[model samples]
Target: MFSKSFVRRALSGLAIAGCLVVGLPTLSFADGLPGFTLWGGVKGEDSLNFRLDFGGRAGSWDRYRLRIPAKKMKLAVEQFAISYPDYYKGEFDTKNVEVIVKDKSIKLQEVRWNKDNHLLEIYPEEPIPAGSGVEIQLANVRNPSFGGMFYFNCQVLSPGDVPLLRYLGTWVITIS
Candidate 1:
């Protein structure tokens, strides 16, 4: 026969030990990930809403890479353009921007950067088909030498039959 107090103490010790064992590892794992205290999450509606985050040793903004997942068949992109809205006057270079799809480097036949209208139209030699995706590598990009929120509009021109570039959505990027 076990005493009541002895049984209670044993259970209490087991509970405390269980919490420390399970909780310590979770706290450690969270520390390794990027901290988003300064910049908030994405703030717009879009199908391929894979929000991009920027964080590094404060001074270095050599280049940044972003992956834009392929859109569904509804409005497939034949030739797309990253139009820097008429309002935004940030000084980022588009001369060294490169498009890569599925580990293969793609050549953009036309790279138009209209500093006046703030639009960078990128026309690929081969149109990106449905169900495929691409990664946009913005090299030699000096991303806002400061920290804040920057939004970019992505418009797509669908394949045959349609002549207009449909409005997709806005890419909400946060820099911290």
Candidate 2:
């Protein structure tokens, strides 16, 4: 038979343990660079507006939620831009864009582009955890047309620790 005080202490301990278990990961991840940006857009040359929602109430380590509005365009897309600062003048290869969700590789199928719009469609190869986010790395981005362009149309997903030259690109997200 346990006393009232014992029960209360047990409950308090359980609550604290639960909080630590839940909060530790968020804190650990909080220290690392923020994840990728999530943009929204349509297929054709039409413009789409979207919103980015950072989950945390205040401070850093906030998670972002993207709001992609409905559109009457051919395809809804989210775009990001990668640019180098003035000092670093070099060309980047536009062919190396990889999307990683929670360390799992995601396949980005290249969509037929119209002029400068290098489009990619995101189909999650594996099931993504509910609250987990992704990282978008544009490796070898050293092309003439690859830097300093205003990559809009989608929501900016992650707020990185360093000033990322890449605009996190856009997600070819569907808005139905």
Candidate 3:
């Protein structure tokens, strides 16, 4: 039979080892999202939601669902523009870009990805009515080779209005 002190020590060691075995998985390392911070002065109302269908990894191909709430669309949008930071080098497939309204794909006159200007312009075949919630679908997007915070400002040009782009909201996209 084992001595009393030796038996106690063995049980303690077993407990510690069991804890480690259970806790190790929770502490395992993963390249995940950075801690959240309010880097920009954007207010809650001025923020837009963009979802990455797949985990946004560097150098990975993914799809982006950029959503525009109805409250943000106070004017009928003739053209939608997304202006990203100059350092963002992600590639977009303009041919597969889509505008969705109420789960239906809206026809687009053209979708332009201007590398020099760092803009993705979406022109619908017909003007999107005011107060309509819309989703801009960007397919076959190649994430940049590096991870960083990218601020995408959304602007819209209204039909029969001043030829100036009006600010709608901002999408703060982070690729890990």
Candidate 4:
């Protein structure tokens, strides 16, 4: 036994609440979008490697390199992602970076980013044909330049407060 006015008021309140919940995310997302960049670099002793340059206070960039022996020229990079703190906010611009193999550029497709898992995965549009020595470089990254402590890692996602680190390793790809 309720009046029409009461029911109308209740419905209006619920609608407002729903709109607030939905609108909040849209507002937050609009402020600071996340982006990423992909590049290649060489891994070895006493090498500069690659740079994970940041432009703001909450973003960062990092690079990892792997050297494959001539004998092993085929390997599957099944996993590649970047992780940060739950509070961290930013994006990655993938177009600025390039992946060079034997001085020839390779196309990367199927790029997927998972915020829940804090991972970024990419698969080559075309497989690298059997080849000898290959060099990979990860460069041209734009990230947050604030906080001055933003950190990033390859294969393992970390937070911004910790010491900024990079991953360096080698992979063997054999075509047969």
lDDT tens digits by residue: candidate 1, 8-91: 999999999999999998765542123333445444345233322234223345454555665533444667667754544345
CA lDDT of every candidate: 0.61, 0.37, 0.87, 0.42
CA lDDT, candidate 2, residue 14: 100
Candidate 4 residue-wise lDDT, 22-102, digit = tens = 899776443222222233322333122232222222334533233333333333332234444444344544553345567
Deviation in Å, model 2, residue 55 alpha carbon: 28
Ordering by TM-score: 3, 1, 4, 2
**Over the stretch 34-112, how does candidate 2's per-residue lDDT look in tens digits?**
2333553333333333222322222222222222222221231233332223432333333555555546666654422
Model 3 residue 60 CA deviation (Å) reads: 0.3
User: Candidate 3: where are CA atoms >4 Å away?
Assistant: 1-35, 39-41
For model 1, the stretches where C-alpha displacement exceeds 4 angstroms are 1-60, 71-76, 85-89
Q: Which candidate is the best by TM-score?
A: 3
Note the residue pairs that clash in candidate 3.
Answer: none
TM per candidate comes to 0.63, 0.28, 0.80, 0.38
RMSD in Å for all candidates:
6.2, 15.1, 5.4, 18.8
